[model samples]
Target chain A: MKRVLMRGNEAIAEAAIRSGLKCYFCYPITPQGELVEYMARELPKRGGVFLQAESEVAAINMVYGAAAAGVRTMTSSSSPGISLKQEGISYIAMARLPCVIVNMMRGGPGLGNIAPAQGDYFQATKGGGHGDYRLIVLAPSSVPEAAELVGLAFDLSDRYRVPAMILADGMIGQMMEPVALPEPVDPAEIPPRPWAVTGAKGRPKNVISSFDLEPEGLRRMNLVLQETYREIERNEVRWEEVETEDAELLLVAYGTMGRIAKTVVRLAREEGLPVGLLRPITLWPFPYGPIRALAERVKAVLTVELSAGQMWEDVRLAVEGRTETPFYGELGGVVPSPGRILEEVRRYVR
Target chain B: MSVELAIPRGYTRVFSRPAALSEAGFTYCPGCHHGIITRLVAEAIDELGILERTVGIAPVGCAVFLDRFFNCDFVQAAHGRACAVATGIKRARPDLVVFTYQGDGDLAAIGTAETVHAANRGENITVIFVNNGIYGMTGGEMAPTTLPGQRTVTTPRGREPRSHGYPLKISEMLAQLDGPAYITRQAVFDYPHIVKAKRAILKAFRNQLEGKGFSLVEILSTCPTNWRMSPVEAGRWVAEEVSRFYPLGDLKDTG
Candidate 1:
């Protein structure tokens, strides 16, 4: 019930620990380095295992191992490190292991910079690695939401036996905000992982693997995964709408850009532009239905991001030519101002 | 009295499959040493009475189906990340015995970094490394432990150090690390070498049971089908040729 000011990265770490994280493994990278440092200092105190892995690849594999061992596990990294973790992530997804992965975003195609960017939207929502798979992606626009969403990420991952991701950026990770942290979960009350490989004490030996060499066998396994994804899509679509009741134009964004668009909406409304904002919280089970329905009434929908219009394609898919869809993005970690976003809105509104 | 009358009914069973190994038949090629090595490891588990508390990590090579062959709980790792995976399992459940069964390509080439770092961190786990000098599952491709002048599918005209680089001495390299409690390279070509290799596998597993950190037993194995030789001729090659480059014996023992 007590609100305490904490940095966004550290708040996420605290939330994970409270959510009964058994093991934390990661390699250091920019913007998210504080999260690792926080875990290194706090996780051991809570009787949890903390390891600074050799590389991002090793870190994700460690998560896979711990998750298979029937424990809540996690790994954090920035842009470059997340790319290195793709192989393990793919294996984890196919293996149907439950784990949390946090990517505090940074600019990149290569090693762009340590600054904030939303360049990984495509990678996070789409298949970043090989094979047919999807991650339950959550994007938090503020430190408080970031902390709260960490718990939801763990829960949804465990509920569906799927990997979940917290996609945030440097601005949220570096900034400080007041947050009332979630209560620490009782480890005994955590959901039982009947399928985990726990030494087969009194039961049949459990074997955790994602490989099925036979054509028919592999097809069956993939179909099961697709069914689970459909279930998630049916139930887990989440978003936030503001000032949308009678607005003529809609603004779509997420994470850092989404929070900025909130201000842009207010600024545009004050100038009688009649703008509303739709912020997607779940990036993969994206708010397509909401966007599509809003597009039916709005004159135009504009997407703003920190990248060169990566999430814009998804907006267009949701709109489906119901209305005009325009994209405005700033590349290379540029944080566009509210006034700048309002100017883009003015172009679309009239 | 007859010899059979002096012993109990069950006492006559001297050479049966270890209880730790399942009834599932191994999928390895004929004359491959994986069968022997897996049996040896299972034998160690049975002898140590830890089958109920042991977790095996299957690598992403020919032994990728290692989970099917073991009665104990098993988790399959991504290519070359067995050591890291084993480390995670062991650290998460320290009460459970964890070990990785990895081939040369899965341990020394693509996974070299994970292998080295796991050893360096002194993660309390056993590593059963099988070095056959070529990528057997991937059709006799050149491996990190492939010997110079050895001809694999990738090296059609024999491995040239100028182009392919030198064979990696993983045991020798890992032995230098202070974290390892045991590091040994043994072969399984014939009776004597097979006996020694079995002993090495037991020793490595025992180290994990005793809470010793990072023990690796590199067993020089055979790949007859990939080597384009008969089973008998491949065993001879392991004895006469492969043993020369990867000489058998203990490189380090912190015990």
Candidate 2:
């Protein structure tokens, strides 16, 4: 009912609970520890299952287990921790289990640092694990958006029977924001999971397996997964277009980078420069169509990210020579300021 | 060819295939022991009358096909992650009886983190660990439980302590942990050992049924084809050399 002033990580946890999360299995990692702490305290009180798993690998498998049993499950981790979870994530993807994963990204090629960075764009959007699969990646630009996306993640995961990841950076994970929490969903209102491995009671047994040893069987399963993904690409693309109606210069970003780029757009416009921002809310089923159409009008597009221009490739594909596409980004845990981003925009335009 | 067996009219069958075990054709190599273990698990599930509330977690290796034989619900876990998956299911639906069937490589090597932690947390679940001392699914390779001097495809020159490291006794190691209610290592090579193994399995299942904490039955099985032995030789090897290295009987029974 009332808006609660909470940290981004805390809000994400609370929002997930309201979305009827019945089980949570997570290991503590930097920039996302508060979310685990919140669940540890609240889930038990609410008569739900909460377990601090031994490692990120264990946590994801636990999510796999709970989801197989027809329960709403979630897990959270940061960059390196997320890497440890790739094996389990691939299984979850292959099994087509519906679970929510929150990746509050920190810097990394390894255990890089514990500061905010959008370094996981490629890892999140592109299949991070070894498989022919893709996670439903949602990039939330602000703390409120991050909270909202957490709920959307569970909904989408169930709707598509896929793992949906909320891609937030450390800034969004740690910063405090006033968010109006949604009303809790009644678990009874949720539809039954007929495929879950509850038991072979009065019906046929359900087996949640990824092993299809036959060549034809594996091919058939992959085809089914690819079709679902194609449908997601068609209907689930989301984005925010800010002042792009008639702008000659465009800034493309997502997650916290999108928020910083917006400020850059305002600063450039104040100096009579033609600039606007296009913040993609969904990064995997990336908004390629909108970017291609917008590229027709803009003179040039500048892609901004917290990594060394990982999302730049996607922007380039979307532009497809319609406009001159260039990129600028900070490395490791560095967050580019509005001034620095504006300077990059001036360099691109001039 | 003509001796008629005496007919006992009052004789009723004491055992048939358990109701929870389906009549699926087992694909295990002749005398692989996976069939026996699966049968024992099915018998335990039926004896406890938890078939309607039981969920089995299958491992990544040979037992990955456990779903085909178990009439109850089953979930196939990633390589070496059966224990963790079972923990999740048991925790979420506390009323269900969840168990994992894992092999040497899956339980002791790649999935050590999951296995150790799930047991350390005292998760209310059962784990049936099949230790044949080699990785059978990937074509005979050195496993973490492979005995010293044991040769396989990976260790063609025999397992050298310096190069291959030492075999890990995970059952003994896990038994020392404070969290587990029952932890034992038994064999199914002979009828007497098979009987003891079944009793241990039934007890572990009963422990989980009574809400007792972590329980695991590490069955010292034989991989006949992988060992390059006749099925008969494999059983003899399991009794002599394997039994000498990994002693039989319960290592821990806190219950």
- Best prediction by TM-score: 1
Chain B TM-score, candidate 1? 0.94
Give candidate 2's whole-model lDDT: 0.90
lDDT of 1 by residue, B1-255 (tens): 113335566666556778898878899999998888988899999988999999999998899988988899999899999998998888889999999999999999999999999999889899999999999998999999999999999999999999999999989999999888899999877888878888888888888878888899999998998999888998989889898888888899988
Q: State how far residue A159 of model 2 sits from its true place (Å).
A: 0.5
Best by DockQ: 2
Worst 10 residues of 1 chain B by lDDT: B1-10
**Per-residue alpha-carbon lDDT of model 1 for A213-255, expressed as tens digits?**
9999999989988999999999999999999988899999999
The lowest-lDDT stretch of 10 consecutive residues in candidate 2 chain A is A341-350
Which residue segments of model 1 deviate by more than 4 Å?
B1-11
Point to the candidate with the largest lDDT: 1
In CAPRI terms, model 1 is classed as high
List model 2 lDDT by residue over A127-240, tens digit each. Answer: 999889999999888778887888888888998998999999889989998889888988887657899988889998899988898999999989988999999999999999
Chain A TM-score of candidate 2 vs. true chain A: 0.98
